[model samples]
Target: MEWRGRRQSSNIEDRRAEGPVGGGFGGSGPGGGFRIPVGSGRGGGLSIGTIIFLVVIYFVFKAMGIDLLQVVSGGQPTPAGYERSAQESSPGEEDTKAFVATVLAETEDTWNGIFKANGETYREPRLVLFRNAIQSACGNASAASGPFYCPADQKVYLDMSFFDELSQRFKASGDFAQAYVVAHEVGHHVQNLLGILPKVNEQRQNMSEAQSNQMSVRTELQADCFAGIWGKYTQQKGLLEQGDLEEALNAATQIGDDTLQRRTQGYVVPESFNHGTSQQRSTWFKRGFDSGQLSACDTFNNPV
Candidate 1:
């Protein structure tokens, strides 16, 4: 939480000013761009009656891989109306940015040491900042998709607005919770470095949907454990304060697929869960925190 004076990672890609760059499959325009007809109500779009509803639905559909623009245009990317613009970051946002960079640097230090201990060198991954949307080697992403690490590009993508949603919507406030998010994504980078992500993804091709979801759960749980490992490292360095662990645990609970599904849909589907349950998430995180050993994060071999 107290990360103001800490080191910041230089591996940050400040693409916020770049807007959404194009480059996805079957898209058109100069930069492969596209646009969703907002409540402009122009050209037979929805009326103002369900403007807010439609906006929410749009993002939800986008998250579920239903690109409205692509669907409407038959896979043609439309040009952006506005030019690339950069907004001046507020003081709080600037501090948050610095905090993210600091957390990333610490993860780099921790993982580098960990890899060196195992006779390997850790290759640091870049963290990208963007607004609205960003294109990754894996695919195009919107902020609604949440933070993610793309192994294909060896980069982590984040939208800081998620922090506000974390605090206000999920009720998982606190600097530690924010740190946990960054650490969890970085954990994916670690898995990529170790070739675990590629192997698991390759195997998923042969798995049924349910079985693949189970594999994804294991992978996600391991990443949670890895984040806990970072927490353990910070705790050992006397960086953790009171209530920090609770913040992280609360965050894990709030973001559990079951918890989120229940909150949004008033129901839970266990088999559809790609991430673990709330208990599993918190438990695996605690396992790594208490043990502070990479061996303790073997969610695959062990009963998770």
Candidate 2:
């Protein structure tokens, strides 16, 4: 991709130096209670009375349907002492940041024009750059979570090191592939703006696990298609080079749930597939790329 010297987004928040900020009660699962450590020091563990008080507080929050653990931990309670890898910083780290900002800017332009054309306003989402782990409205997440857009906060959280993983582990190397990651997350932001995410999430609540997974697959494929729409606009602006489309398509294929499951576990479970198969992912992306229209990207009603 010919993305140098392009306009970079001003909505980026660089928290790479801040490390992990918020601390919360430790837990083993989403509904797990707080873990109060025990030790043999004056400040080591809480008193029995203090523990009882905390238990009461936990129950009170639970009664109100609020997750106190999640609240104290920012969003999701991540493992303790999650730190950045020593190899996370490379010589091209600054360049990668620039490229990310440029790609975000491109998506902003594309979405803004699209929304304006439809007589609606486009709200650009803030993208946070963090090292290791970060707190988000959706939850606390590490780089292992990859890039995600939180509908609660309307922001995209990313750890740049994931690009390295995308290149090395997923074998989806290319500037356009990286750009596709950003665009896909931003596409979720667009879905949120269009109220697609809210509706889907509402419906998913009453669905079975398999039904929910199917709904999730449709939602993700639509985002892939939206990313393809952004790619189309980027190409029109002369920013895309030869093979850029292939890079993104390859990325879509590599990250498909079936492909990832097979690579990691040596088998694919069709019922658990939430992000669609490789063929579906690349096909939807190409569909949007071929016809840069929202009508072409409706994975919900259309047979994706």
Candidate with top lDDT is 2
Q: What overall lDDT goes with each candidate model? A: 0.79, 0.80
Pairing residues by index, what is the TM-score of model 2? Answer: 0.78
Model 1 — which ten-residue stretch has the worst lDDT?
A: 32-41
lDDT of candidate 2 over 1-304, digit per residue (tens): 9999889999898888667433334422111101010111123678899998998987676676665655676775434444344345566987998999999999999999999999999999999888767777766766656677888888887878888888898899999999999998898899999999989988989999999889988999999999999999998998889899999999899988778877776777899887788899999999988899999999989898
Off by over 4 Å in 1: 20-87
Where model 2 places Cα greater than 4 Å from the true spot, the runs are 20-90
Looking at model 2, the pairs that clash are 76-139, 76-140
Per-candidate TM equals 0.81, 0.78
Query: What RMSD, rounded to one decimal, does every model reach?
Result: 9.1, 10.9
For the record, the alpha-carbon RMSD of candidate 1 to the native fold, in angstroms, is 9.1
Q: Considering summed lDDT, which 10 consecutive residues are worst modelled in model 2?
A: 30-39
